[model samples]
Structures are given as C-alpha cells and as structure tokens.
Target: MEQPYTLEPYQRCGLASLGLAALRAEYPGLSWHTLGGHFRSSQPFWAAIGANVPGGYEQRGVCSHVTSS
Candidate 1:
C-alpha cells in the first residue's frame, strides 16, 4: 500500500544518499546550475544536500549547462 509522506521514514534513513549515488552511477558526468536565488529558509537545505556531490555544485552564474567528464 502507498504510505503517507509524514509517516515515511526518510528522515533517519539513507534514502537521499542512495538516490544520489544511483544517479551518479547512471550518469557519470551529470551536473546542473542553480536557477536564480534560493529562498532564505531553503538555502541550508540546498547546501546540505549538494555538499557531498561527486562533481560539486555552483549556486550562481548565468550558464545553463555544461556536460563533460
């Protein structure tokens, strides 16, 4: 059965990390740029998630995308 969002146990699990690792494996050189400015309250959340990305994250600039290894 489908579970409710609040009842889901993602908080104390490695769900996010696992998902990231899977994506990295599927797309070796995948990367992305931020869209404008982030909400003040969400800055911390964004920082925390991308802090350990394999390539690195740049939350600024005008370039849309650059694909390479």
Candidate 2:
C-alpha cells in the first residue's frame, strides 16, 4: 500500500487515477480485507507518527496504549 502514494507530489486528476490503477495492477496479490484489518489495527500508531507540519506537532492528542484503551 505504501508502494507509490507515500510522500508523492501533487498530480492532475486523470493522471492520479491512472497512477492508482497502475499501482493496483502491480500488486495482483494484494488483499483489501487483510489490508483493512491491518490499517484498523495500526490507526493509533499512525496517529502517533503523524506528519511533521508547520506547527511542529503531529502526534495523537492523547497517549494511547493498545491494552489500556
């Protein structure tokens, strides 16, 4: 899933669609169901590592532990 989209620059709408299609074609064995499961499980981790932007803040607002929450 991180094969192409991560940190990419802007693109026109048509080319963006084509790029997504190409990415899909390249990963024939990819499973959306498994991907969704992992994504769901990792949401908090992603929030913890959120983008560093102008304000120098990106992490989750609250500390979250998998077992605690």
Candidate 3:
C-alpha cells in the first residue's frame, strides 16, 4: 500500500508509533509510560541517531491527554 504522505520508511514507523500513543492517551488502558520507557530502553541508539537526523527529533509521540485527564 501507498501512503499519501511522503515520509521515508523509518519516518513512517515513527509517525505510526506516535499516532498509537495519541490514541492511547485519548482512551484508558493505554500505557504511554511503559511504552515510552520500553522504546527509550530498547531504541536508545535509534533515538540518538534520530536526533541527529534533520527534523527527526520532532517526530515524537504525544500523550498530553493522559496527563490532562
């Protein structure tokens, strides 16, 4: 399948993960803390590398709903 946006493969994955985090925040039973922690622990290198990539650091998940609610 083709995506409407023009993001690269890794960028797509990162956006999808961020979207999942958004949905989880809207609904209960979604654990952003654990997920974020897991991602941090498992993909420390990826995060570091992403930071260096242009516009990579901005591709982060939003979980404000979890905290606001």
Candidate 4:
C-alpha cells in the first residue's frame, strides 16, 4: 500500500521527538495518552512514542496493546 505524505525513514525518530518535546513544552506536566483508533501501520509509532509520554499509552478504545516495537 502506498502511504500519503510518508515521513523519511531516518527522520521519523528525530521528528517525532521534536514534535513531542514541543508539545510537552507547550503543556507542562500533562499526562498524554493515546486516544481513539489507530491505523494498523501507525500503531507502532504511537506505541513507541507513547512510552515517553507521562503515562504509558493509555489505550482507551484501541484494541492493540501500545508497546514499543
């Protein structure tokens, strides 16, 4: 399957990190959780980043366990 506006392979980590850091900076001491449904492909990314969040991915309505791949 083709991905739309897919991120470069090497840029994923740095980009995600920066984005999350910016969010944290904007909202200090806020608990971040993964809410709603995640795509089968994006699930891995969500799980990976969710770990660094204040709480491990609080898988609300998500079916799969959010864990680092």
TM-score of each: 0.47, 0.26, 0.26, 0.50
Q: Could you report the Cα RMSD, in angstroms, for every candidate shown?
A: 7.8, 13.1, 11.5, 8.6
Task: Give a tens-digit lDDT track for model 4, residues 1-69.
Answer: 123233577656556666777878898887544444557877777677667766645356434566555
The candidates, ranked best first by lDDT, are: 4, 1, 3, 2
* Cα lDDT of model 2 by residue, 1-69, tens digit: 433333335532345345544755788544232122334644543334323212322333332332322
- Compared with the true structure, model 3 gives a TM-score of 0.26
Better of 1 and 3 by lDDT: 1
lDDT of each: 0.57, 0.38, 0.45, 0.61
Residues 13-54, model 1: lDDT tens digits: 656556666877898887645445566855565566567875
Q: Which residue ranges in model 4 land beyond 4 Å of their true spot?
A: 1-6, 9-11, 30-36, 61-69
Give the poorly placed runs of model 3, Cα more than 4 Å off. 1-13, 30-69
Give me the candidate number with maximum lDDT. Answer: 4
How far is 24's C-alpha from truth in model 4 (Å)?
Answer: 1.4
Candidate 4 overall lDDT versus native:
0.61
Model 2 clash count equals 0
Over 1-69, each residue of candidate 3 has an lDDT whose tens digit, in order, gives 122233555663566555544665687463323333334443653455345343433324666665633
Top candidate by TM-score: 4
Write down the worst ten-residue block by lDDT for model 4: 1-10
